[model samples]
Target: MSRFAEVLGRLAATIEARKGADASTSYTAQLLAEPARAAKKLGEEAVETVIAAAQGDKAGVASESADLIYHWLVALAACGVSLDEVAAKLEAREGTSGLAEKAARKT
Candidate 1:
């Protein structure tokens, strides 16, 4: 795997470990304590990312996108969803048209 992928995997593992940690000390634990809060944070980050992209701020978009992915990973961890599960779903969609995928989901 690439170094970036390895780092992301390690970060996900660390976040998962922090899920049960003391909320007073761990930000991940604090997020895990409240699902709605985590979801809200993810949404906010996503909006920031979009705004950065729209404003043509490459650096801002990268920074906000990082925040967005972190929150998304946190939300997934908080909900007991593993990255492997997500990867499997993506793998299953390989070679499929994006429109077809959306149509299949609606069925």
Candidate 2:
């Protein structure tokens, strides 16, 4: 598997393990209890990453991106999606152009 797929697999496993855990014992569980809140956190982190990129702060961008991805995985788990599914779609888009890809979507 590619690096991103490996990471996504690990994240998916972590999210699955966190499912049904006690809120006090696992932060992921706490977030899963309210997936919307976790999703908002991911959005906040994504904004931070954008700000970091705008300022040319590579370290901040990496850190915030990691946080964003973590919360995103949790949110995805709560929504019943798997990392494999996402990876498959990404793989399917490997050779697609951005404009064409967007236009081809069933919107």
Candidate 3:
């Protein structure tokens, strides 16, 4: 498995651990304790990632991608989703045509 995939597992574990964590010691705990603020921060980081891509800044893209990943894990914590499921869905789609996939979704 890719190390990046491991990140998703780590993210899940971190969020789970955060549930009972001391806010002073765990940033994940702090984020889990907030909702709207956390969403706003995630949005900001997503925009930063987009801006970095648009600006052709590789380093900026790398930094913002990390931020995006972090906030995504936080948001997933809020929503109670599993990375494994997402990866499975992606794997299922691997051989499908993009156009066919979009058309299939509309039916």
Candidate 4:
């Protein structure tokens, strides 16, 4: 696996481990305790990422995108979905045209 993928996998495991942690001490646990809150955080991070991208700030975009992905992963965990499952879906889409994938999803 690529180093990036390895980092994400490790982060996922760390997040998963925090599911049962004390909310007062663990931000991940707090997020997991209220999935809606986690979703909201993901949305906020996405906006920041978009703003960074629109402003042509490479560093800002990179940082905000990392934040976005982190929040998104937390949201997924809050929803009881694993990163492996997400990876599987992505893998299943490999080689398919983006338009074809969209069309297939609509059915």
Candidate 5:
């Protein structure tokens, strides 16, 4: 696997392991215990990432994107969604035009 995939896999596993941990000690646990809060954090990170990109700050974008992905994973876990399920959706979209796929979703 690519380094990116390997790191994300490890991060996801760590998040899963934090599910029932002490919330006061583990931020991931706190996020998992509060889905709404996790979602809000994910949104905040997303906005930061966008702001970084808009400013043409390559390093900032990369850093903010890492935060965004982490928060996104946490939000997904809090919502009981799995990475495999997300991958399945992406796999299903393979070869489909992005515009067509989006239009199909509007139905």
Candidate 6:
């Protein structure tokens, strides 16, 4: 596996393991326990990442992107969605024009 995949796999595994943990001790558990809260956090992180990128703060962008990914994974986990499900969606988009894909969504 690529390093990126390995890292994400490990992070996803850790989040899964934390699902049954005490929320007071594990932030991941807290996020997993509250899907709405996890979704809100994901939104917040996404905005931060966008702001960092807009400001041309490379380091800030990287840091905020990591936060964004973590919160996104947590939100997906909380909603009982798996990485494979997300991957399938991406795979389906392969070779499709972005504009065409988006236009199809509107129908």
For TM-score, the strongest prediction is 5
Candidate number with greatest lDDT: 5
CA shift of 16, model 1, Å: 1.0
For model 5, how does the per-residue alpha-carbon lDDT over 2-36 read when each residue is reduced to its tens digit? 99999999999999999999999999999999999
lDDT of 4: 0.93
Steric clashes per prediction = 0, 0, 0, 0, 0, 0
Off by over 4 Å in 6: none
For every model shown, what is its TM-score relative to the native structure? 0.94, 0.86, 0.82, 0.93, 0.98, 0.97
Q: After best superposition, candidate 4 residue 83: deviation in angstroms? A: 1.3
For candidate 2, write residues 1-107 as lDDT tens digits: 89977887788798899889999989999988887888888888889889999999999988888888898898888778787788899999989998888889957
For TM-score, candidate 1 versus 2, the one ahead is 1
Across 8-37, the per-residue lDDT of candidate 1 in tens digits comes to 898898888896799999888999989899
Candidate 1 regions with alpha-carbon error over 4 angstroms: none
TM-score-better candidate, 3 vs 4: 4
lDDT of each: 0.92, 0.87, 0.84, 0.93, 0.97, 0.96
Q: After superposition, how far is residue 39 of candidate 5 from its true place, in Å?
A: 0.2
Q: Which regions of candidate 2 deviate over 4 angstroms?
A: 1-8
For model 5, where is the 10-residue window of minimal lDDT? 11-20
Deviation of model 2 at 100, angstroms: 0.2
- Candidate 4's displacement at residue 58, Å, is 0.3
Better of 5 and 6 by TM-score: 5
Off by over 4 Å in 3: none
Question: How far out, in Å, is residue 61 in model 1?
Answer: 0.8
Give the C-alpha miss distance for residue 29 in model 5, angstroms: 0.6
